[model samples]
Target chain A: MSAALFLIALSAVLALGLGVYAGRGREMGLEQWSVGSRGFGAVLVFLLLAGEIYTTFTFLGASGFSYGLGAPAYYILAYGTLAYVISYFILPPVWSYAKKHSLVSQPDFFAAKFDSPALGVLVALVDIVALIPYLVLQFTGLGIIVQIAGYGAISKDVAIIIGALVVTAYVIVSGIRGSALTAIVKDGLIIVVVVFMGIYLPVHYYGGIGAMFATLDHAKPGFLAFPASGQSVSWFVSTVLLTCLGFFMWPHSFAACFSAKNRSVFRKNAILLPIYQLVLLFVFFVGFAAVLQVPGLKGAATNMALLKISVAAFPPWMVGIIGATGVLTALVPGSLIMMSASTLFARNLVGFVRPHASNAQTVMVAKFTVPVVALVAVYFTIQGSSTIVALLLMGYNFVTQLFPALVASLMKRNPVSKQGAFAGIFVGVGTVVFLTLTHQTIGTLIPGLPEMIRDLNVGIIALGLNLIVMVAVSAMTPKTAMLPAE
Target chain B: MKNIRLLAILPFIGMLAGPILHNGVEPYILGMPFILGWVVVWILITSAVMAVIYKYDPANAEGDEP
Candidate 1:
């Protein structure tokens, strides 16, 4: 076997071992398994949240985005920093509520807060639908990472199967704790590898970062900045705002807050996480470096720009290290996604249906659901054909529909009736599905609009419609008394 | 406390100002594209702003625990 494949296999084994070991000696109750018994300190919570944030998406998609689309990729950095800023205010209340009620999943928070199990089921459905695509994106990134870095000895399908199995195994055994442990190693390796490649490539190729930008700008004028039409400035601003609202709406991220020891853990992380987001600048640098050095990577293949450039620039052993890092990137977040989805499926969807299932029974259902979810994601990764960025955007459009209802329920009076929350999510998600399937955008839906208005993200339209319907429906319905969170 | 919490809005303005103020590529700030540099600066400013809010927000007071 080549050194690259050997290193990847070794790291996969290490990840599996560490993951299984994390659950050792602890009773794996439903809460213990899903939220680390709600006892994580600031550092672990930080790593867990950061682990979800810097997934294969950050490792590959960010660079590939900058490599393919230029200035549009800057939205990745902008949205995340804003998301952290929003998190500072929102997460404390969420943490306290979840702690007060021992909420294990994102839907649990919604169901309990709205006093409606049907709304929980609605949120669960949206969560699963949105999360599967995101999980598939991670598996696809793993497939690409291994196929390229392993010198093409393994096919993409085989790599995905192997990755899915390893993630499923650890997640079933260790749950969220396992993901958190592996996240420490994953973050450390990714920081070193991304920073080294980001700086080294620019300096090596064109003498320095400044000189590299100068060369690229002269060679391809207007390529590094957003144009006036598609992917324009309006698109960037709207996308950043939409994703900021939707960031914590992600089920794993929402549930991850339930794992923190105190409300202060979130406050501290909000201060620190944006600094962590700055590391993505190196990811963009790597992408920019690839644009000049190893050009001609178009479409979905642009996701390979980071790995391709690294393979060309470094030797086998070095590429092996990078490949290992990529594997951890996919596994850490993939496991968390799987964990969250299964818990949501079992605790909210199934438990709602049965209504009398014991806690241990629910945990069993979650454990069994993990491999099933993994299999579904693996099948989609093999069959699906969109770029990683496209896949993530599709998921975001669906998931962001939950934002309005979530924020409304957090208010002191909880103005939105349960029926209103249901209608809002239904209409919002329906709009996303309709627009996505019809291949329509703001430009096509309404003609004669200016370039700026036309360029706004379609998700913003869904969110706007969602708010209007929610308010309208709530105004017509009898007010539901707000439940005391304490 | 409410006024102090409003400090978080600064990041939203700083970042979303990209299109209006920092859309060009003429003046590369520290070897990066102009918009990219604008974002990097705001990221730092966001951190500093959040740190200030964290210091004074009454939610973090010693007796604030529920």
Candidate 2:
């Protein structure tokens, strides 16, 4: 076998081996399969959370955006750090409530907190819709890595199929623990590979990082700074603020919070995660390095910068290692996200419909739904969309609409009734879809707005409208018995 | 401790303000580009500030068991 094939096979075996090994002597109970039975310490929880947040987007998309769009890419680093700071306050409360009520999913948190099965069902449906495109993006990313690394020996479609099967199988057998174990390997490799390319490419091409930026400064002018055109400062601000709020709104992220042993786990993570975010800076270095060396990669081709640089600089074997790292970056997070969506469907939606369902039955439904979700994602991936980062942003936009309702649910007097919450979500998600479909930029729906307002991210706009509707509707509706006395 | 809940907004301000206030390429600090250096500094400061707030926040009282 060629070195690429051999290394790819080695990565496959390593992922599968670690995945299966994690399931040893453990029962496939719903709790164990979903949240690791709430037994994870700080280190394991930290890795799992980091692995979930840092996906193909971190490994490929951030660099691609930096190489292509310039200053807008900084939002990736800004959001991660801000999100962790937000988590220091938000996650512990949610975790405390989740632990108190045995909530295993994001929808479950909403349902129990607000005392509305209907609201829970709505949250579940919206989450699944937002997440399917995200899953498809992962599959597409894996296909890119495998196809590029295969060098025409293996087809992209077959590689994607094999990749999907590996993730689904390990998730079925080992559950979240499999994702966590593989995450350990995935993260270790990612750090080494990214750090190596980060340092190597810059020094080899442009003397050093400072020299790379200095060269880009002279060659490309404002490319090293925020653009004075198109994406304004407000866009950067709103994107960071909205993403920080929406970070934990993803079902899998909320579910991961429950896996921590205590609130202190989250507190500890908040402090160190910013330091972990330093990894993205290294990824940024690679993008800057590529800007001068590998110029003229247009559109979707820009996503190939890191890989192109690695392939050009390293031997086939080393390139294989980088390629495998990229594949695992997609696989580990893909499994966790698939599992989270399935849990939302099985526990939140199905259990709502079938209140008499047993834990065993719920576990079966969850396990069964995992592959089906993957299949849907695979179907979309085969069709292929070049909007991987856009899909992720859309996901965040719709999910962050839940922030007001979530805050209300945790309040002493949640004035927002279930009716208000449901209406707000529909409006929020609807607005996101409408704006995205129409190709309308943020703060521009009204037309003739100043560039500052027009430059804000659409998610923040949708969220603003959603919050308004929530407050207005709640004020008009009479409180049900479920509403606490104020 | 009384106003520690307000600390959450600081990271937002720190992160978003970089592009608005200092979107220049000059004055590179510690070998990083200007905006990149600004972000890294805020990230470290955010961590330190959060750690300080975590120590003082009453929600994290050692005896408070969930």
Candidate 3:
């Protein structure tokens, strides 16, 4: 069943990627390819904005957290909605700033703001590296979506790997437009699926959302609360902070935000995106339903809970559509990840490394990187259970170092030191690696903090430390302030 | 500036409303709780904010049409 669905999804991805890239060849130039000629409408803006939010992590990780944590999973809803509203004001100012200066990537903004390519490159590197594990989750999602649908007997790994390769080919060929067009279908389909499931799931599984949570709460008290069973307040605080801070850090967010013709759309999307989050109120139930009904497999089956529960509940065709949408969710964002990664390689890394490369030459180098990284994403999805949301937050933590630098650079004083910016990132990454490897998750990963404050949620903690060091060091340092505005 | 000030309040309102509504605190007005009422209010506020931003035509935003 999963295999059949897998093949159909693979074709949709093929059509989506090739279709967009083919619509307007790379002639749109780097800027156009990356940002859709900077004239996207309300519809494209809406789809791209929504697509940036609804990644594989939204499906697998949010629900998985719900599966494990129960009601407090509402934090996913809280954070998701909170993210949109915050963006309303923050993004408009950023959009205004970007327009005033023609900022391309988040790194470009940081670089111009700090008056240092080194700082730009520093954040750029963080953006690219942080996105890798996240990209892997998306492909792994495709793989699992395929495997469950039993798509004509193709193995899940094969289905996922194939889907990723096809998307990569067109992303390489077309650049950003390729990814954006496909996002339209993927984002649209998921919204439809979510709306259907949101209303239907509770009715089918637990009489209503109220009843569902009520049943789960009575059966398992800790699951319904924010501080999950055996979890502490410190962990909850840190995790919510990590998730919130991570919002702007995601690569897809950077790509979509940069492409906006003006900040107004960014502001509008910011205000409206919470409505999408409201649509996601279903995720809490999806996860809780899995915990109550689905056969549990430790953390092994967490990623599959969505598909398993969906397939187990609906008819096969609806399963096929949901499965296809899930694959689309993975592929749509996955394409953006690779697309952004490629652009960074061509325009940022190589351009930084080579310094005098032509735009054509840079694009060539980026086109080459597309497939190689897609292959790496394939490797992770195939061999692993796919760390969906966990990986994205880890990416978020790394990106937050740039936030201080990001906000600082745009304003009068980019009071963040490039050296300190790098230092904070180094410490942030070190915290994630040390904590994650030591078998202790931050917040929910470890189930408790105080046990490891320095361990999990390193991004927020390190970012604070980074700010302290950057400001103190900047005070002692020269006052050249890299102000890049009107 | 007045509109912008009102706009800023929207986010704080959203943040406050999030945890409360999704916790499934469904008190019906006629049938819908203060929560659903809040959501309707949120949508209204968001529209108003957008309308304000559009109408204000902040000097920086005039040349740009996103």
Q: Best TM-score goes to which candidate?
A: 1
Which is the winner by TM-score between candidate 1 and candidate 2? 1
Please give the lDDT score at residue A256 for candidate 3: 72
Candidate 2 residue pairs in clash (backbone atoms < 3 Å): none
* TM-score ranking of the models: 1, 2, 3
Q: How does residue B59 of candidate 2 score in lDDT? A: 69
User: DockQ, per-model, please?
Assistant: 0.75, 0.70, 0.21
Indicate which candidate wins on lDDT.
1
- lDDT by residue for model 2 (A1-486), tens: 668767886897888888889998998788899999988888889998999656987788888888887767887888889889878867888888888777899988888777789989999998998788888878877887888776667788998898899888978888888888888989999999899888988889888888888888889888877765467677788778888888888888889889988888888789889988788888988987888778899998888888888777888898889888998899888988899999988998899989999999999999999999999888888877666556766887878989889887767667788888988988999999888777788545677788878887777768988999988888888653453321
Q: Fraction of the real A/B interface contacts present in each candidate?
A: 0.75, 0.68, 0.10
Q: Give candidate 3 regions above 4 Å deviation.
A: A1-7, A10-14, A17-22, A25-28, A96-102, A228-234, A385-391, A417-420, A430-432, A438-458, A481-484, B6-66
Against the true structure, what is model 2's DockQ?
0.70
Q: Encode model 3's per-residue lDDT on A1-486: one tens digit a residue.
A: 354464466556565645565555347566766666666766677777788668777887777766765544555655555556556556666666666776667777666655678766776788887878888877777777777766336777677768887777667666666667777767777778877776688778888766765676567754554342234333444555557656766655765776666666765665566666666656655766777778564675676777778877877777787777777777778778887887776777777888898777866787788888888777766667436445655666676655665565555655566665555555656666554455454444445445535333444556666677677766776754555455
- Model 1 chain A: weakest 10-residue lDDT segment is A384-393
Fill in the DockQ of model 1.
Answer: 0.75
- Candidate 2 chain A weakest lDDT stretch, 10 residues: A477-486
Candidate 3 chain A: worst-modelled 10 consecutive residues by lDDT: A225-234
The per-residue C-alpha lDDT of model 2 at residue A319 equals 82
